[model samples]
Target: MFKVGYFYTDCLVPMVGNNPYATTEDSAAELSINAEVYSLPSRKLVVLQLRSIFIKYKSKPFCEKLLSWVKSSNCARVIVLSSSHSYHCNDLQLCSCPFRYLLTPSMPKNVQNKIKSLNWKEMEKSQCIPGIEDSEFCVRIPGGGITKVLYKESSSREIPMMVLLKFVSEGDNIPDALSLVEYLNEWLQIIKPSVNDSTLSALPWKIPSSWKLLFGSGLPPALF
Candidate 1:
């Protein structure tokens, strides 16, 4: 399993329990935690949440103690949560030190491609369309499967676990949403699969009234 580290402030702890993905100490995670931030729904929520956890009890020793935690922690990636007030895109960025990575779900290939087609860049320096940014946490695999976890490094110990996010393009093609259901359906074949059954049951989300107006009663997506 990937070791994901999340640091949020104590103030937001109460609110996180409401998140469908909110993790807890009892989970089989590498670690579950609590943190502090200035307030809820921050202007710079994600970073502020990290800051909150960094100086939870006091603000005096912020930099020094955080650096120590970074050096000692065995986490591979960081997951930062933004306050409800955030209105920007769904993405994550890592700082320059510690050879670290940031994992933000929904940063899928389709989203990236759509962003690029519109000539938007993920960061300020590069246009989203022109660059292929680095991300170790989520890797893409061809032929419609995702390699989620490669547990061990050695050749003999290595294990490959595949996850299908959604389906693909054009003529005689599978509908994206329906294909996603099938993709997830394949997970049943794996030994101790990562996905739980509840998610599968939520196969199709009820389309909002606004979305119905946009897509004309939920038409299946055709590949471009």
Candidate 2:
């Protein structure tokens, strides 16, 4: 399962746009969920999506409820995809990699080992305040909305969760989405890698029709 933020209406929504296997109708839940589930006799993968509306105000309850539902559903792992302000990248963070991950204390040992084998950098931890033992070493995402909250709450509950995020500035985030998906593929293999046949048809993933409007027809030929 994955939860993506739409801070600028560009976080990860487009990735789920085109051909969702399932979608939620208007509902009364704190958030709406649309899912694409791929199931075999032995394995399953579900991609979940929730719009970022009202998350700032209701993140705690929302995440708790969602995690509870996931627990009930017998899901084993959760991966959240999101972005943070590139400017917030510290000297060390920037020097390391464009992407980082956060792992809950309860994360499976195998997963942690895989991350280590890949040599991916985990988000550096910092004290919430200048100096306070109570603050402790914690991963901080300066402009990453709801990411910290979700990680904290999930960790407290001992849910197996991981977050993969990129450092980016707001703009044409379509490229960011592509980069993120590729990064995830490096870990999850969502799309099969290849040296030939660059078409997305090689995978079940579909591009949403909404992407066509990504860059509009260009200022009515006047602002140019």
Candidate 3:
């Protein structure tokens, strides 16, 4: 099961496209929850989208409740797809790759093993303070927006959660989203493996119609 973000997760839901074998709608009056549920029986996948504008105070409680629901629903694990500010990339992280992941301490052993088998690079352990010897190395996301909170909450509750993200900056982010999906597919295989990078890149991915206006009609004709 996945609770993908509408924007920061690289617009993953739209990339998943629409229509499934079954569907449902769920909301909570007390929590300002509005979501559309999609079920793909053949793939045994369920997606819950909570894409409304975020208010910090409201989102804190909302995430708490959502985690509780996930626990009750017997979800095997949670994978959060998000991005980090490219500027936050450190020298070590920059040298290795733009991608990194964090696994909650309580993730299943088998799950942990599988991730290892893939030879994926885990986020680097870096100095908490540049010159403080006793300071601990910790994970930080300067502009990750709610991702840090969700990871902390899930970790505290012992929920098996994994976050996969890239270091990126604002632009025509459609390409970023596509690149992100390709990264995710390396693990999930939501789309079948292809013969080559070119073939793999050609896999049909549908972007939301809303994106037609992503660039906002361009440069106003560059009036001189």
Better of 1 and 3 by lDDT: 3
lDDT of 2: 0.70
The lDDT for every candidate, in the order shown, is 0.30, 0.70, 0.70
Colliding pairs, model 3: none
Per-residue C-alpha lDDT of model 2 across residues 59-137, encoded as one tens digit per residue: 5666666778778878789988988899876688777779989999999999999999999888888787735878877
Q: Which whole-number lDDT from 0 to 100 does residue 163 have in model 2?
A: 92
Top candidate (TM-score): 3
Off by over 4 Å in 3: 1-34, 127-134, 195-199, 218-224
Model 2 error, position 5 (Å): 19
- Model 1 worst lDDT window (10 residues): 145-154
**For residues 64-170, what per-residue lDDT tens digits would candidate 3 score against the true structure?**
87788779988888888888888777777777778788899989998889889888888766667856999898788766776778899999999999988888888
Per-structure clash totals for the candidates: 12, 1, 0
lDDT of 2 at 142: 78
lDDT of 1 at 215: 34
